[model samples]
Target: MATEYAFDIASDLKTVQALELLSRHISGLTLTWNGKNRDYLVGSTINISVSEQLRSWQETILEGFGFTPTLSVGFRFHNNTDFDAFSEIMFQATMLLLEHAEDAVLLFNYEIIVLQRLGGKLVFNAGYQMWDDDWLKSRLSLPFERRPLPSPLL
Candidate 1:
């Protein structure tokens, strides 16, 4: 078993148009807008958590890639596996991000301290109680924030 059913990608989408590129590649993917962001032509994030699981009988596919950055990124993923599936996805997601930024440093933190299931019972169980206790927050790209300042009154 592995960790995670969803993945979120962040990058500058102006020249790369990352969302469009990824949308074409990922299966069972959808592009959503929250109507809360107003940054144009700079940064875009794509969330891609899938319900599919990679069967243990199959070999783990390693992309052999990622980045070397130094920024703080905080994110939590769902733990959907009974074994190391969660850890494997952690590596996979790192590679996925590496494919985009090519220069980031991802550290696991506030992890495992993290989802969803449906049934008539609607039961919930949480493992890795202290998941993020250590931490692996990453620095994907250069630290960047888009903020519009007010004009001065003359």
Candidate 2:
């Protein structure tokens, strides 16, 4: 069963502020939810991993408050994003959550960045990426090495 953490984060604050408040309640990476769960980005998928780390948190910090908070953290990630990009963020987020699974549920967002050459002295960075399964319109037709550099599927 899910019990309130007793700290209600404000809705009106900017994204960064909400992050700050949330960190106070449960330190580490997390995703913020908008009303009705609409904040979820389009084309995202939820992946969950279970481990002994989660067990330790529930038994130590949460169980004492009459809160038997038992859960694998939940959130979403873009389904079509590149594997390498997702892997990097996933690795980091998972490690963090497992380390503090007792503190709170983690909802984290991952973004990738790519740097490319522009004019002689200028460098351009792309915002998002085209992944393997992306459609006919996808630029993935090119090889990962030959392909234009990719950015995180933010």
lDDT of each: 0.29, 0.31
Clash statistics: count for each candidate: 29, 4
Candidate whose TM-score is highest: 1
Taking all chains together, each candidate's TM-score versus the true structure is 0.31, 0.27
Runs with alpha carbons beyond 4 Å of true place in candidate 1: 1-16, 38-75, 79-93, 110-154
Per-residue CA lDDT of candidate 2, range 1-154, in tens? 2210111111234333333433444333344455542232111233322212245654542433323344333334445655454433443433333333322322222123221212111121223242233331242232222243343232
RMSD (CA, angstroms), candidate 2:
16.5
Candidate 1 lDDT by residue in tens digits, 38-100: 111111222332122133211111121121122222223434323343343344444444355
TM-score of 2: 0.27
Model 2 / residue 140 / CA error / Å = 31
